[model samples]
Target: MTIATELASPSPSAAAASSASSADSASGAAPAVPPLLVPKGEYPRPDLDRSERWQSLNGEWDFSSIDGEARITVPFAWETPASGIERTWLEAATYRRALAVPASWADARVVLCFGAVHHRATVSIDGVVVGTHVGGYTSFEFDVTSHLTAGRDAVLEVAVESPADKRSIVHGKQRSIPRDDYDGVSFTPTSGIWQSVWVEARGRTYARSVTLRGDSLKGIDVAVELAGDAPAGAAVRTRVLGEGAAPAAGVATDARAESATDAAGGLHPVDAELRLTADAAGRASGRLEIGSPQLWSPADPHLYRVEVIVGEGAGADRVVATTGLRSLEWNDGGLRLNGDRLYLRGVLDQGYWPETGLTAPSDEALLADLDLARELGYTMVRKHLKLEEPRWLHRADELGMLVWAEPAAPSRFSPEAAALFEDQLEPMVRRDGNHPSIVVWGLYNEEWGLDWDIPGSRRRAEAAAHAYDTMAALDHTRPLVENSGWAHVKSDLVDWHYYEPDPATWAENVRDLATGVREAFPVKLGPDFVVDKSLYGSDEFPRTGVPLLNSEYGEGYTSLERAWHLRWQTQELRRHDRYSGYVYTELADVEHENAGLLDADRRRKDWGGLRPADVNADTVLVVDLVPRAAGADIEVPLEAFELTVRVSHHGADAVAGRVEAAWIAAGAPLPASPHGEASSAAVPAVSPFVLGAPVTLTIEPPAASARLALFFVDETDAVRARSYLDAAPVEAPNRRGARPAPTPAP
Candidate 1:
């Protein structure tokens, strides 16, 4: 048998580190006492779901802690209240559960899988140790067939250790003691088994892992890694499931199909077999071609399911995988999806809830965030710092949202820290690479872990360059970012974080953005800050034609000013041909970061007259009449003003929309007919959303400051489907903080 039955021995230093982590956990503070049982027993990997041959090991488990033995939930962390043991940082804990193997799999190989353990864990079945793993964010497995007696009660035990100090490992936002790099952005730490645990029964020759890639429209590449050697003359059978089928049970058919469907009506995706004679490395790979493939996009997220089966008859093992066909590239100095120039109207999603800490309350709870994003008109999300659950990524695919997958940044830099950073980065990309929604792989964020002493230091630059090269090699299917904030070191995209709240100052800054940002860094971040003064050899910015994006901006106190700021910032970014898109600071308030469009409890913040559809739309209409003086009178006499209205489309889908504007006195009702005076030329939807000829509307203002309401109505009669722009007087500080329009209660 090729599968090893013994657990790998730990090195002397690793053993010492484990002991130290245990000691730290014992000395740390305890979290609120979680309940005795709060189960998350669902199948962990829905992307490759195999529930028929699997059993959830999630409910109650006998746990032993510093406070003594107690019953705790299997998936919820020990520190989370849901686990019934609210202990913040615990030393070493042992979890024991009882289960009986299915009678039909008496001689089959049984594997136990854990989605994620906090830091480290050792697993044993019955009484023999089976396997061990040392990462908190990646999934791990153990072969437990030999340790179990079939059709009988078997005891499964796991010992987990989580270090109190985050510096001990590559702990991402989890904090016990706050540091400069972590402070307000970091959150409370969680420990123990924080993800699902389950068991799978498979044949002797099972498929261990499958890596899917490439766009489905052209052809998809598939590689399967096997466990144990294939018997003589045995071949590996692969098939892609027809739409609407359960992911695991792919339609059975011939080796390959000439059309999209077979005679039996099963999907005819590239079905083929690999002869074991050429499998020297226990790996098989091939390409799949499908006719009339559906492309995946934020508006239409379509996924294709595939299955790889090894062996034959009752002893066969099947592995399922889901993927979508979509190409994401930065070419001709702009971002494109499926060869169409597209702008990413996105928001930064922190992936934190007030009660769950790191984990969401349920799968639906996570889906609610996506639903909220779509409702707010955001096409994409930058999943900041934390790596979310796979189901969350799947939901993004189902809901038509794009994701920029970011690695969790460590707080400090050291030799061990560097090792940990590279160690986890590869698995993160490999595991999530098949998902079409993840278009970009983010290496580090704003230099959180690699913060060196000197600005533009060689050490920092070298480190970033190395990380970029390393991540690029693993997954060449998506764009790679070295450092997101100010420093640009060999990255596909150069992103910036500008939080200037004043509209006029912001306008001045954007006037000379490329240069003003370069010079303002040292002063903005202080002298000792760590940032590169040049990108490669370019003194101002990267001259490699890399796309530019304002990854973060916006912090206004009042509803009126915030709305205006969002509109102004988005409009300004759109003006620059080189600027691909912009992602606002956040979608919702996370803990103390109150700059979200929605508050901490997921409540909508009144954004004056602006709705989500207004801020994030493929087609937008902006009325730039020029700002009035800062201290202008509250009331103005009726006067004629030249309003230059610009109508532009951000997507490649050219649309026919009519523009209509009307002047209404303050507090006066709008006309019910929904008609206007002037007709707008057809707005072509393409890369540069700017209009060639601006529609100069001569507005005869009323006695008071009149509200100029403009609408970009589509061919359809749906008004909300179109974007509306309401021009109003900017408010002062005291006028800020007005209660936002009431939303359906959260």
Candidate 2:
């Protein structure tokens, strides 16, 4: 959390006149031009304390083609509209920009930062090499303090080369296609400064890195690292803020801190704490306490905020960070959070934007996801191998959305691929570890990493397992999901995949193989195709006593209207009592996978007829049990009008159960088991019941219906199974509206 406030010192807009041709600008035309999209919005990092004086170099920059006869936009690759260049490929490109340094920065150290650059990038200022950085997901900075001239403008240039198909780097889901196979979509690779670029001034000694850890029993511990030279008696102070206006502060001696002096004098380590307090705002505070703290449960999430101040002997800068305090433990029972059994109602989130592809439409678009999850009764989301921008995590923390962060794995597992995965994944975790929303680290998905039966596959699995263990050991605060969907080895949780409509089929399989074998089984089933099941369970589950969970289900692509469909389907399925919980196929659609609850544009489909349960006071008929003794009776309540009940029994003697109906308000005893068959003792206004165990009952109130309880009983009162029929208000069909459409196959 770095906070840098600067007075509005207007600079020349990127839209200023340039000599480049329009064909090379973000908007491709006759004259190639430069990208004019400046980074004027608030910088993403507000938690970090930064200087007030700064400038953005993100907009238009001078450009020249590195290869061939094509010319393109400065920052945007030749392939995107925002770049004003639509060339499909760029083997090499050079970008240049000029900025006038203010006389105020003459005596101050100057630093240049690039939000992101694809593949490899080299930076040069005034034709002198300054710095270089690899990898596209992380940010890099260079201290250009020595290359500054007072009141004189500086020329900054960058050379970029990216073969989007290269497997050596972490490209996430970017694809490479034949030259002529381009589709009219924004799925092409984005290169070079897709994010903001700015310059900030730092004090002689500044805080480098901060790591915050919390233990439920021992409270929170803060570790801070500082950079640059520190005086002998330097001290670092940290403050904790929440609902209270004032913050609590803690001080530590700089002499005891571990310094990254050899490596650019960056701070490597510094530890402080705030005990749990009742005044903490829980999830509302944007911060919380640790000791005996209200743990961050899926049902009720809580987070804490930490502020760090670095003083050189006495005068230092300050930074702020928001984090959640909780712990994850893996035992024979399964994954547990805060010492409680945790069930992951998760969705595979594919971070994609219809307009910007990997880039989000806006910060609001990111926050909308968490809000949607809360509405749908989900608490967790798997990032699905893609690392998101930091702002995404910030929203997750604020919305209390738990995250399973996975590193993108190569399609094939080669020795080189393994090295690449390790290289990129380690830094990703270290950079994102501070966020409380990230609870699980997923190593591999399915067979993405290695061949299941190959000789070397075992070693790969072992190495992956060891890597998972190492991450857990490094920060035991979160659980490690060794492999997701398939390929379970020596891991903590047993994860599996199934793609069948019948949930009971897989449930029985697990029962026969694990519990029936009577052997020690630590594997927990992670069903991938459970969302499509119509009947969650069958007769086999009652006999086998197998415990099953709905790990994956409901992946229908989201549309505005589909929201109603989801509510309808969810209500219909919960009555079965077979699934533990459901993890929908996806949170957002990525590429061609349209099975997302949200569209690529991040807009919710309009569900016209169906309303949120809260807004519409419609009562649903929930039948707890279907069949009982013929002489026994059932009970139902009136809430909504629609009623449908299915009864099934185990015995051949259908006469064992009976349904005797009664209207409690009218004081009239009605006939038992209405509909299907006629009985000898028939009461007025009551339908008869059949001798069969499973009898279908349909009750349509004849216009005059009251808020009354309907009771069904047998002679002995032994068959006490009940069904509830709620009275629903009549809904008028919308003749002006379109007809109801059929639900699409998931």
Candidate 3:
């Protein structure tokens, strides 16, 4: 929607960078494969990385599915055209691939890992059952050291079942039986083996996982988990580097440049080392203090390089991670990060692509979404109903994008389904909680698993509460919302979703919801039906003294009119100082949902030649005029119109700027050129006006149509925000169709 083209296209170099980190390139065991099936050879785990010790099994694999047996791509689901098995979703499938054990990895333990497998997966190596994983949205792994001999090939078989009855499992936007479910918002299924599968070599007594807990005022608490035959008193050494060091040695130059710079551009964070001893359970933790720490936020996402080593040199394990040192809290009825008020000018990201389903085409594809978010002037993005790839979160850390992470939810209510929902929270938190970009964790959305009857069923309310407590135990640093958008069973913030087409009414409801004057949220369950705002909330979570945000708000449609609705709807959000922030319905089109700034192909719509950031910037100009029909031009008086304008500044400091206005006729040059070029002088410019002041706009009405454009320019003469008003001259009643003359005579 914005004119800036900062996102990079997926290139062969990106794929090479990923595979080069793996040992397969050195061993030369992987067969030459078609680029179409193996579009990406990227590393799946940038966090907690031991890149060189791993081998990618992400290219071609022997595959079969319910839709009929065929060869398929490893990470691409069959439902997508990219997967050679381009057919309808298959509920069951079996994959067989050859796993070559490099002779150099003989002394280390070989662990098989899956970024994720749909619904249910049973894995076996060399005819021996290794492990089974349920819940498709979380990562799982197994150690297969005993089954394989060094330099020999082993058969890796994975049998997967993604039941058609998705109501019993955690499926995000993926559709199941009753295809019209989710109000027709569900999409093609992301079935088995949809994410990367790989094997990494680790020491027999190595660090399996490391958690970094960072605080700007204090320091970092490094927690290490060791697996395999670890000694009773195993020790872990933690070293956090300053701004310039790479995460590890032998990494590519592009990756090194990514890790070396801090977006905050502040003083270098403390570089130091601390050691801790593991007990019988093989756990170790220690805190490293930084005298002056650089905090991470959307404005500046500065990551601290962390390296941890376990055991001694001969049989040691090493892991490199990038951690952000930051802190957030509630203050003045709003969320604050790094002691500054945080207004989440956010967009809802569904994390889907036309060809890749949910899997990324390349590592750059993940960064492209964050790049789009930054271009649109969004400070945050609410990942709707999906747990995205770790590379996405890692790029958010690099590019300074805040995230509100939510996992997939079930479609129906049942005790078993509720347990499945509860079971998924721990892994979600454990996997994602360390990232500073993720400011909040959401469990369920709109009571989907509770059959949307949170008010009627006590059992449903208990399920929501159980999830709240489960996540509270795993993570306390970030805010937790049990049920987002309505009926907050247990949450740190009271957020709601109201999709009102009328700007005046949306403004009224948003102010009321923010002030507690309105307790119930208006629900638009479907196009033909409307449920009035009746259900306020249950008694489980109190609403008093909490931050209020409209987590979702927008109308459904496409193009300039859609952009028009986004502008007005979000204006109401920024107008109310009582509110914290807002997340628009979406960033890109998904399946049947057309309420997106960009299409499913990630291309901008025809927004009437306007930049989307004009209305979405952190510091924007809000004009006080309710919109008329979105596609139609307003019939203003022949000469002039009066309106009030104000600055809605959410930056860390107060805003200082001048507001400029100009009127240009149809087919005229934009105000962007020199103050008055020949083409631009068809209309005139208005004198500068102070913000928050009423100003009269005058125009010598052109014979055709015209547009009144406004801009907010800071002291540096750079335009920070811009808006437009389409107008046509008012016409008198038709004289030819004169029944009026006869009525006057009578």
The top-ranked prediction according to lDDT is: 3
- Global lDDT of each candidate: 0.66, 0.48, 0.72
- Off by more than 4 A, model 2: 1-40, 47-56, 66-78, 99-111, 149-152, 177-187, 230-234, 242-302, 313-315, 451-456, 501-582, 606-746
Per-residue C-alpha lDDT of model 1 across residues 1-746, encoded as one tens digit per residue: 11123474444344334434443434322221122233555566778755446677877799997889998876778877777888876768999988665554553566788777877787887767787777677767776665654556668888888877676466677775635454656667767887778777765567777788755466567877776435333457666675533322332222222132344465343433333321766677787766667788876788777777777665566677888888888866678888777677789998877766667767667778988988888888999877788888888888778888887766676656766777777668666888899887888777767763314466766677778888888886777888877667678887777777665666666555644344343214543553433323225445647777778787576655566577767766655555677888788876776778887678887665556666677666655533432222123535666566665666554555556667555434344434675445543343345442366656555555555556666667444223333434656458577898889878
- Model 3: number of clashes? 0
| lDDT of model 1, residue 179 | 51
- The window of 10 residues in a row where model 3 has the poorest summed lDDT is 1-10
Tens-digit per-residue lDDT, 126-245, candidate 3: 777777788888887776766665566779999888877687688978888755357477888888878888888776577777788786447888888887656458877788866544
Top candidate when judged by TM-score against the true structure: 3
User: Model 2: how large is the Cα RMSD against the reference?
Assistant: 14.5
Model 2 per-residue lDDT at 74:
33
Pairwise TM-score winner, candidates 2 and 3: 3
Off by over 4 Å in 3: 1-37, 65-69, 242-270, 533-535, 539-541, 631-633, 667-670, 673-704, 714-718, 729-746
Candidate rank order under TM-score? 3, 1, 2
lDDT of 2 by residue, 629-666 (tens): 11112233333233333232212123233443323322
Query: What is the lDDT for 316 in model 3?
Result: 68
Using Cα atoms with residue i matched to residue i, what is each candidate's TM-score against the true structure? 0.83, 0.63, 0.86
Task: Sort all candidates by lDDT, best to worst.
Answer: 3, 1, 2
